[model samples]
Target chain A: MDGVHDIGGTDGLGPVGYRPEEPLFDNPWERTVFAMSFPAMASGLNLDAFRHGIEKMHPVDYLSSPYYEHWLFTMEKGLVETGLLTEEELRARTQQFLDDPSAPLPQRSDPAAAEAIVGFLRSGAPARREIDAKPAFAPGDRVLVRNLHPKGHTRLAGYLRGKRGVIDAVHGAFVFPDTHAHGLGEQPQHVYTVRFDSVEVWGPGADPRTVNHFDMWESYLVALDGDTDDRAALDR
Target chain B: MSTDHVLPVRPDYNADPTPDPVVVARVKALESLLLEKGVLASETVDRVADLYEKEVGPRNGARAVARAWTDPDFKQRLLADPVAACAELGIGGMQGEDMVVVENTDEVHNVIVCTLCSCYPWPVLGLPPNWYKYPAYRSRIVKDPRALLRGEFELDVPDEKTIKVWDSSAEVRYWVLPQQPPGTEGLSEEELVELITRDSMIGTGLPRTPDSPAGAR
Candidate 1:
């Protein structure tokens, strides 16, 4: 989905802010939202699904809200949409808190679940899988990013569509986000580090001293013919 | 305290130090619901938060950087296979499952960004800072990184050196292997660890030199 979340190469957002001593999380609520994301996923929601939830948010709300708010929205949307919790229950629970801020939350101690969550955090869930297929392009091979505009979730940034780049390295096959985000399937494919010259991406006015590299799934790229003129392909 | 005085209103909630009361209520509500529905255990959230706050962070990345600076063979291994090299140092997991370390040299410099979302190497760097997830950094960094680095971050790259920005759009996570600072030939690996800051590894700032002022970070 070409949402506000895909904000690469856009301009006039504002200047970046830096705080050298910034805390990991500002609000206690932020911590809760961050931690809950794990168990929310453990409840059968995959990472891509969670991301798509955020992507589905209204553009204005998505941009105006804080980062953790996005996480919280995703968690809530996933839980409710999956029937783990109902809207009325959530609304009543929220009202209870709003009415009595000091209300004690229900707690259940499950040391085993806690341990499992920590273990998973330490040993990540890798998406890489063995596939009996050869990569379409290799290092030094010129490739053009497919001009895709999927209505559903996709990892391909808006600016990268229709752009041309060179294959820098071939990362092993990994779960493709495009299909995975929609619960279609893992659809694991070869991922590559495609290097795009600054001029190629931003055009002639871009700074020549810089280049951009994107980790692109194989399906997102089309192999360019060796005999094809680079300039002609770029112009096209 | 008497509730009689006029309190100052923050113009921007994003910049305000105080937490939003509604957000706090909403999170507590979600927690209560999740707990009641048996979706999450009581201790799970707290434990995960503690793990990130106490155990995981940029210090882990710093240790790897320091070791790579001191050991040439390890540096080669780090560049060749980052995930295994990091695991060799007991640093691997989560968002860092597929890791790539790009080295910064005199001729080339590397930076990491995820314009799609705030995808970072969690096991090594923990949670990303607020600025990293904000629109200002995500939207503009890819287009005019030199300008952003110089104007907002105060790290000016010379015109001659090339800047390579890595957009981590897929499963692979990328980080920078910031060049070891000069005038630290005699320092031990442990001592060298102090020079590596989070921003340096993120490519917004350079590592602290031996003569840099105390508490510079």
Candidate 2:
């Protein structure tokens, strides 16, 4: 996502706006990823089914955690959820964690559980990202990235703030997100690259030696002057 | 590995998956499946993944950077018809997203960081080495721009002014047009182009010249 701020800069989502001053921690499982945990805990899940529902959640837990922190957290959570270990057992495990020489890897010497974790990890790949062989526009073509700003997980950027460029290549078309991330399922749209001139973008006093180019989605471009047919000379 | 390889040039994905086992495994599993399906070579996935930052990928934004370095009139043209202005040069799109270029200057030096999961302009600049997406770089950068850049990229700019750090989002991508190298009073187009290092071009540092070739401190 490139510089698509809310129309006229309102920070549309209200307070809790972009706070550059607040730097989140370097820990992979920083509190942010788990902010929804409270609601989840309140609205508990129906257990009593198949090796437990969280058997396959290791990948999500692990990738986003700080080193093996996920191992400690997920293990305890998993044990308690499946009734294999009670909350008191969780308490003892916590004390054991404190007493351990070093936190060891998950003892999934059990092949089925290890397999479950493996399957969970493999789920991050795209079933079909819905990308295409050809793009809406190709290299050297003139196009526009429609400037839009909506509150949600955005792929757009803010650096190319009101800037432009030419298409250097039409990287095989991928699904463009209609909402935020393509993960939660999205309406994939066509994307492209539109290059621009340095001097043209920043005023003459800017560098006089290099050109600036950037990427955009089909929705971003607004055919300036209706020069669609002339798109032939675009990438030239 | 050569020390040169450590200076944060583009990264080789073969050895640069995100530092998370699960994430790496998931990606690997998918790549393996893609290979089995004959959709890609077993190594082809590694090679294509390298395009994320290794070979100075998309950079459809380079024309804007080049134009910024070249024609003043074109600069104005960029402000108005950036996409069209880019078409005039011969740079195009990558990642299916339209391209846009931003300029960083003396008053305002722009450095882009994807505070959320390394969303970079891979089409033009190249794959973002693993470290760029590291938590150390991402979490601290926006708050203490000078510190993160200094620690990671070895850039030690003064605290006299607040550096404008632009965080590229998953929705849009960004590329920086670094200042041209110094001492090239009469360099040709190819010479100048060769001088544009992916790092400097991405706003991590300035492009190098014969005098300051390695971007030494």
DockQ of each: 0.59, 0.05
- State TM-scores per candidate: 0.95, 0.44
- lDDT by residue for model 2 over A125-181, one digit each (tens)? 221245544455656655544455544334444434444456754433444554423
Count of steric clashes across candidates, in order: 0, 104
Per-residue lDDT of candidate 1, residues B1-217 (tens digit): 9433554321123577677778788899999988887878999878999999999999999999999999999999999999999999999989999999999999998888999989998887788888888777888888878988989888999988999999989888888999988888789999999999888889988999888887665
| Segments of candidate 1 deviating more than 4 angstroms | A226-236, B1-14
Cα lDDT of model 2 by residue, B1-217, tens digit: 6565445432122232235443333223322332333323323222322333243342444445655666678877765545456657653344214334556566556666665345565445544544455444554444445554565566655555335555553334555656666676477655566566656655556666756635342
Off by more than 4 A, model 2: A1-236, B1-32, B35-64, B78-89, B215-217
As a whole number from 0 to 100, the lDDT of residue A232 in candidate 2 is 34
TM-score of chain B of each: 0.92, 0.68
